[model samples]
Structures are given as C-alpha cells and as structure tokens.
Target: MYGQGMDAAPNPWFSWDYVERNWDEVSDRLVIHTTLTLQAVLIALAIAFPLAVLARRIPRLAGPITGVSGVLYTIPSFALFGLLAPFTGIGRTTVLIGLVAYALLVLVRNILVGLQGVDRDVIDAARGVGYSPCECSSPSSLPNALPSIIAGLRIATVSTVALVTVGVVVGYGGLGQLMFRGLQSDYRAQIMTATLLCLALALLLDLVLALAGRWATPWLRGRAS
Candidate 1:
C-alpha cells in the first residue's frame, strides 16, 4: 500500500528519511512511553512488596494471595482497559491500572519466594547475635532475598514495557500510538520505527535492572566468582 505505483513501485521498507522528518514527534512519544512504564512498575512494587511480606509472615495466606494475583494477571489487556475506561475514563490512569495489575503477580510471587527461602538457622543466628526483629528481617533476611526480588523486578519491568504498547487503543500508548497510526496510513517507516523503539526501550530497561540487581547483591557475584 505504501509503495503502490502505476508503473514502478518504490521500496516499502523502513526509510531513514521518514524517521528524520518525524524524529521530534517520535522522541516525545518515547519519553511518554518510558515514563508511563516506569510509573506502573514503581506503583506495582509498592503494592506488591507489602503483600509479599504479609504472605511470608502468614504462610497459610500465601496460596490464596498468589491465586488472586494470578487471576488478575490472566485478564486480557483489552478487556481490562475496557472495564476500567468507564470508571477511570480512557487515559493514563486506565493504562497504569492494567499494567500494575499484571505486574503484581510476578512481583509478589518472587518476593514471597525470596523471603521464604531465607534459612531458619540464619534467621535464628541473627536473633541469637542480639539482633532486633527489625535488624533480623531487614539486614539479614532482605539482603538474602535480594536476588529473587531483583529477578521479579527485572521481569516486571520488561513485561510492563511491552504492555505499554497495548495501551495505544486507549490513547495512552507511547510508541504503540505511532504504530497504530502507521498501520492506518500504510506507512512502513513509521511502523518499523515504532516497533524498533519498543524493542530498544525494553532491552535498555532490562539491562539497567540487571545492573542494579548485580550492584545490590555483591555477595552473589562473589559466590559465583
């Protein structure tokens, strides 16, 4: 469609000229997309961390909490957006709600597993050394759990980045909006640019999180070495 011609058709692939012409608009959308993704991840972490701690504290409740989060994760993005549109009105709020809900399952499960994995003897050792409950949990247990927590964070961050693209229908999608417009106008350059940007953003965020994880858990690196 983009290269249709009476005699000879032009190439329908990506065009650097088109990208140069639309660079400003694309850059703006990229910022918005990155901001929205990060916001969703931070909010989800705030909600999930406390619940994860609760699940660790009360072993019996862990299964039910996980089951609930799993159910939330299974809801289709479009369906969730539709459901929230009436209450929140179609915008960033609706998009964020959907993203945060999806992130909770992964974040909460990983945190709970991390905390639970702490050895009982190590916890006792902390207490036996005159460590207060707070110290025992935070300094001792939390550091040990950092690996799992960071793993969950990495997964949630990448997943949210991808999901943000789905928000294009509700008008909150960053690059997704570009992709949708490109499709309607049969612009291969725009489509290719948006898709590549999305991939790049996801990879960039994942790499940053991986580095942060390594920094947070130096002991793991030491053990590996």
Candidate 2:
C-alpha cells in the first residue's frame, strides 16, 4: 500500500541528509547512552558484590535480600521514573538510579548462586591445609564463581542498555530521546537509527563480557581440551 502511493513523495527510512543534519545531536545521544549504560552497570556491580557476599556469609538474610531485589526488578521503568522524579527531579540521575536498581537483582543473584555453587569440600580442604578465610575465598570460591558473575554482568549490561531508552520519559533517555521524538513525528529514519544503535550497543557489550568471561575462566577451556 505504501509503495502504491505515488501521489505522495517518497519518504525513505534511510536518509543520509538526516544523519548529516543531525550528526552532532545523534553523536551526543550515543555518548550519553553509553555513559548511562556503563555507569549504571558499574554502580550496580559495586553494590551487588557486597550484598551478594553478605548474603553468602549470612544464610539467614539471603532470601530477604534476593526477594527485595526481585521486587525492585519487577517495577516498571516508567513507574520508577515517575516515583523518583518527585524526589530526585527529572534528570539523568533519576534514570541512573533506576537502572542500577534494576541491575541489582540479576547481578546479586548470579554472584550468590556462583558462590554457593563452589564445592564446600574445596573450602574445607583449604582450611585444613592452613589457608585463611581470605585466601580460601579469593583463590577457591570467587574464581569458581567468576563465570556466573561475568554472566550476570553481561545480562545486566544488555538489559540496562535496553532500559535506558525508557528514561526518555524524564527527558534524559539519551538515544531514547531521539526515538521518542521520532515516534511523535512519525520519523521512521530516526526511530530505526535509535533502535538499531541500542541493539548494537547491547550486542557489543555482551560480546565484550563473553570474551572477558572466557579469558577469566581458562580452566574450562583446559578441561575441555
């Protein structure tokens, strides 16, 4: 139907003119998007590690801690922005806070699971052989758990990249801002560009994390060989 409409001038989805005219805006948005994704993931990782370790250390608190994270993850992004805007005001900070909160559930759970998965006997043996708690955990537990923690990082980063677009609601959604405007104006090119860039960013981050995981866990490769 769209192709048959010869009465209207052709409106293509790929327009060099669009990129040329809005190069600065698009580039700025991409940088903002990357900044938001990176900062959120890093902050979440910092918070998650301590929480995960605490949960592992204290078996009684593990369920409540993870349950709270699950609750945080289930809150809709827009709803989070709405709730935070009144307190933090509409800005990047609000979005960053929400993104970090969303990432916590995945990161904390994965780290906890990985730590739990490490064989108890390994730790016991290390303790029997005169290793301190610090040495046993660092050399024995965390390394074995590195794969799961890395997996969580990859998942959280990709999820955060996608979620950052929802921040357009608070006027700081990075590329999401472009996509929102495009939607309002029915600008297909802008919409496609934003969508594609988001996907590319997520994929790039995931690939990097995957490679990092493989490098961190060389024993898996050695075992297979």
Candidate 3:
C-alpha cells in the first residue's frame, strides 16, 4: 500500500490537457516574465551607459567601474536574490534589483569597448572641424559606437531573461514559479512548458536586437556590399 503510488507511470513532457486547462495562467506568467526581463535590462542600460561613457572619458576610472560590475556578475544569481530579499522584501523589487546588477558587467564593458573602438581618425577629424568634446561625442562618438552598444544590449537582455527565473527565490519568477511547482510535484509538462518558453523568449529577443542592430548600422551593410 505504501509503495502503490510509486509504481504509477511518470507524466509525459507535453500535456496538451494540462496546457488547455492552464493556458490562461501560462499567458499571465509569460507576460510577467517578459516585463521583468525588459525592465531590468532597460534600467541596467540606463545606468551602464553613463558609467561607460565616464569610463571612456576618464581612463583611470574605467578599471574600478568595470571591476565593481564584474564583482556583481560573479555573485551567484540565487545568492544575490537571497541577499536582496532581506532589504527589498522578496518580490519583483528584489528580483529586479538582482537582475539589473547582474546585467551591468556585460552592458558596461560592451559599451566602453564600443566607444573605445570608434576610429581615432573620426575623433581627430571632429576636433579638426571645431567640434567640442561634448558636441563631438554626441554626433561622432556614440553613433560610431552603435554596433557595440547594440551587441551589449543584446547580451544583457538575454542574460536578464535567464536571471529572471531565479526570481522564484522571491516568489516573483514568472514562469519560474511554474518550474518550481513542477519540481515539487514531478510534473514534467509544467516544467517543460516553462523551460521552452524561456528559451523561446531569449531567441525572439536576440533576433529582434540583431535586426535592430543591422538597421542602425547601414554603413556596415554598404561596406559589405
């Protein structure tokens, strides 16, 4: 009698019936998951851009700025959630804070690298034409750095998507909640659904960014052609 339930067959990965019954729930969670990911990435970019620009302009500060973000990146995701939950109190806020912190390293490094990579010739030309450092940066520096910035954004956005699932630690992980519940119940369909959606979301976002990057950098296309 005690072993009877253990003899039952395990559930299959794709349970149409389960999805049919829970599609509304899945849709709601998916929206939450996407919102959290986008918000975190956007916030990180806003913070990282100025930091990257400052680092580029002041070479001495570059190391320390990147170093701090690198340190934040190195901390395990779940551990960060655990640490923040105490102060932020376990929810979207705690999760958003953690996601944003983790994204900084990639976003900052990429933006700085992109800025540094801009043709020195362009900077010299801008100076030769009477552009102030400030005027030159807006028109010449950032535009030239777009590819690298876009690349950084793509990486940060995808990384944020994955990190959002860790929000389960704070009871705010959108699809992550489903994965957690599935784990407890050994429900294969629920876990697979959430995992697949996460993967799909990442791919979709990456594709969109890739397209956007191309659109923004027509010179590269012109050069290639």
Candidate 4:
C-alpha cells in the first residue's frame, strides 16, 4: 500500500523556479495570444455589426448569413489551418484568419439578437420624435441590446482563448506551446501547469471583460450584475 501510494501520487504543477526561469517565454507567448485574439475579435465585430444591422433590416438575409458562419465554425481548426496554409503560410496571419472566422459565428448571432431585442415601442417613439434609425438605435437601442452584446462578447472571448491555445498546434506561439511540449516530453507537471494557467487566463479575461462591459454600458448593470 505504501509503495502503491508513492507510485500513484504525482506532482503536476508549476513551481516558482519553473515560472521564473521561463518568465520571458511565457510572457511573450501570452502577448501573442492577447494580440491575436484582440485583432481577430475587432475584425469580427467590424464585419459582424454591419452584417447584423443588415440582417435586421432584411430579415431574410439572417438565415443564410448565420448558416455560413455556423459552417465555418464547424470546420476543424487543423483542417482550416491546412486549407489556409497554402495561401497564408503557417504563421500568425493564418491563425488570426481562422480565429476571426470562428469568432464571427458568435459575434454575428449575438449582434443579431441584440438588435432584435430592441424595444419596438422605444424605436417607434424615437421615430415619432423625428429621430433617424441610426441615431435612435445608437444610444437607446444600444442600451437595450447591451446585455446580449456583452454575452456574445463573453462567448467570443472564451472561444478565442481556446482557439489561441490550439494555435500552437499550427506553429503559432502561445500557452499551447507549453502544453504541446509537455505532452510530447511526457512531463506531467508541465502539462498540468499549462492547463491550469490557461484556465486561469480564461477566467481572468472573462471577469475583466464583464467588468469593462458593465462600466461601459450602464444599462447592463441592472441585468448583468
């Protein structure tokens, strides 16, 4: 029993020395993930917000547009990487493109939901007051849509984190490098540490985003808080 206990127990987490020794590598990889995710999300929002507005106006467009996004989301990440490798090569751009594409599914859907959730009476009142749709929607409707928009952003952020980790599988640097190397080398401690760090990062990102969204959109405080 004593021998079995010793054999079964394993230390699989990062130590202070491990983190200190690799601080630069870890920080650089985290920066890469942050930059990649931010760029991809911004691109997605740019495309998605317009598409969502269009979808709201011409309801018929929503079906096909969302269907296309759904299809893109279902494509295996590695497969998409392979497909893009020919054109973009195996670098950050290729990973960014894939991440943006994946993010669109969530962003567009959320934008659509947010737009649709705007109170029709409020919209009518705004129009009755001689306000243009764009102007009316910008402030009032935006508040109504704030919660949904925040939710979508949250989901997109999470997906971005996971996808960024997978980016290492395609030769793009991130925390996934630690995970991949640890797995390849049969280093249980490193693998566990990497996984925990990734999980912590995801949680931290979500909290920070939520706080930012709440602070930026006061209307959401009533509902999101």
Q: If scored against the real structure, what TM-score would every candidate get?
A: 0.92, 0.91, 0.91, 0.87
Worst 10 residues of 3 by lDDT: 1-10
Model 1 lDDT per residue over 71-149, tens place: 9999999899988999999889999999999999999999888888888888789889897655665624558888888
Over 4 Å off in model 4, which ranges?
1-12, 128-131, 139-141, 217-225
Candidate 4 yields a Cα-based lDDT of 0.81
Which RMSD does model 3 reach against the true structure? 2.6
**Which candidate ranks first by TM-score, i.e. highest?**
1
Provide backbone clash counts, one per model.
Answer: 0, 0, 0, 0
Q: For candidate 1, which ten residues in a row score worst on lDDT?
A: 133-142
lDDT (Cα atoms) of all candidates against the true structure? 0.88, 0.89, 0.88, 0.81
Worst 10 residues of 4 by lDDT: 1-10
Local distance difference test, candidate 3: 0.88
Ranking by TM-score: 1, 3, 2, 4
The superposed Cα distance between candidate 3 and the true structure at residue 14, in angstroms, equals 0.8
RMSD of each: 2.0, 2.7, 2.6, 4.0
lDDT string for model 2 (78-138, tens) is 9989999999998999999999999999999999998888888887988898987656655
Q: What is the lDDT of residue 82 in candidate 1?
A: 87
Give the TM-score (vs. native) of candidate 1: 0.92
RMSD of model 1 against the true structure: 2.0
